[model samples]
Target: MQQHPFQISRKIEYGMRAMIFLASQPMDRTVPFREIARRMDVPEDFLAKILKTLVERNMVRSTRGAHGGYALARPAREVSFLDVIEAVEGPVVVNVCQDGSSHDSCKATGSCTMYGVWKLGQQRMLEVYRHATLDRLAMSDLRVPEPAPEAPTRPAAESRRVE
Candidate 1:
């Protein structure tokens, strides 16, 4: 299998999945971690770390006890893709030149011809991300399909042929 050059990290991917699931669920209902993991097909341990990051960022709320679980801290409409991505991956940077901290490293920060292009691209990317809120994603037709049941096999002895 070929790997894509530009791809989100597993952390970000899983975080998005969990967020969407939570958004789709009733705001009054607290979903269990196991249910989220199973429905989203994310590893439990990996989901745990992602959830921890989200919880710390105040994007998700966690509860303790039998009926307690997890839910979105804010309304789904208030949370955007940028929020989730930035929550997990930090600020999105199109290139090293776009990073303020790396401006000193790049000698052509101000004079590069491609600077405008990178800036425009970065701006557009962030705009799209900011526009894609959890509410929109949850409402989209992106549900995980249930697995098909396995067919029953016949006994080997019943398949014997007469000579």
Candidate 2:
């Protein structure tokens, strides 16, 4: 059987998508869970569970009533990607050693050379995620915005002329 590389799963994808949708909404507005679920095409129950976790972590606030729903407790720029991920999925440690949960039964406790490499990579990933706020992510586009027009400035000898 082929071994699959460990990475963020579909749940994380759906959760992030749902969060981006929330971020897109006006800050003053509290979106209904059902509406978010429908718009994001995520299972209502699953998204609700994720939202509950976010609420517990104080990343989001929820209200109870006919008009009550969910909204970010603070500005999107104040919330980091790591906050959301950690709220729903717990800490992003890759190994038991990093989590300090190693047991005596484990044979490779102190002999793994790759552990150091993994720890370094993990730290970098954490820093990137922690520094990347939801506001930045919500505005992330691979292409640059339109550039201003300007006259060409180059010597005739160095620049190619149009046919």
Candidate 3:
């Protein structure tokens, strides 16, 4: 899906899910690829790419060989949401105008009425994400809500006219 200005990419979302799952698991435990994929409901192939980026960023560690899997490189408390987002998608920019590389492209750099708005918005977002550590998220009740029970259905013959 194409990501809007504020919306995070699917890769970043999946990476967050994967990170939360790992943080919830015992620190000593290394979760396998299949298990993370199943629990996060993330496609294995896509998740592999996300994981690779995270591993490269030093946010996640991968183990090879028998009984091998993945785990956070550091304690969950040390890893923040911003870290995960930045690992998968570079510095979190709320607007293109905030991105340094795109600064020259925009006709209005210092004169734009919305520049301050975007700057403040990006600052606030970064602060929130930076403070949202994985340990806190993992400790919260983030389990998927149970599916509601199905309503009772009428028997096929009951509502039908005999004629």
**Which candidate number would show the highest TM-score if scored against the true structure?**
1
Choose the strongest candidate by lDDT: 1
lDDT at position 130, candidate 1: 97
Residue 156 Cα positional deviation in candidate 1, in Å, after optimal superposition: 61
**TM-scores, in order shown?**
0.79, 0.74, 0.79
Residue-level lDDT of model 2, residues 1-163, one tens digit each, is: 5545567866777778777777766677788899889877899999988898888888888888998898888898988888888877888886665675653334785787767777788899899999988787773431234568898888887787677
Between prediction 1 and prediction 2, which has the larger lDDT? 1
lDDT of each: 0.88, 0.77, 0.86
Tens-digit per-residue lDDT, 7-103, candidate 3: 6678888999999998887777788888899987999999988888999999999999888999989999999999998888888777788886766
How much is 77 displaced in model 3, in angstroms?
Answer: 0.4
Stretches of candidate 2 off by over 4 Å are: 1-5, 100-110, 139-163
- Residue 2 in candidate 1 has what lDDT? 67
Q: Candidate 3, clashing residue pairs?
A: none
lDDT of 3 at 43: 98
Q: How close is candidate 1 to the true structure, as a TM-score?
A: 0.79
In candidate 1, what residue range of length 10 has the lowest lDDT sum? Answer: 138-147
Task: Give the TM-score comparing model 2 with the true structure, all chains together.
Answer: 0.74
- For model 3, give the 10-residue run with minimal summed lDDT: 138-147
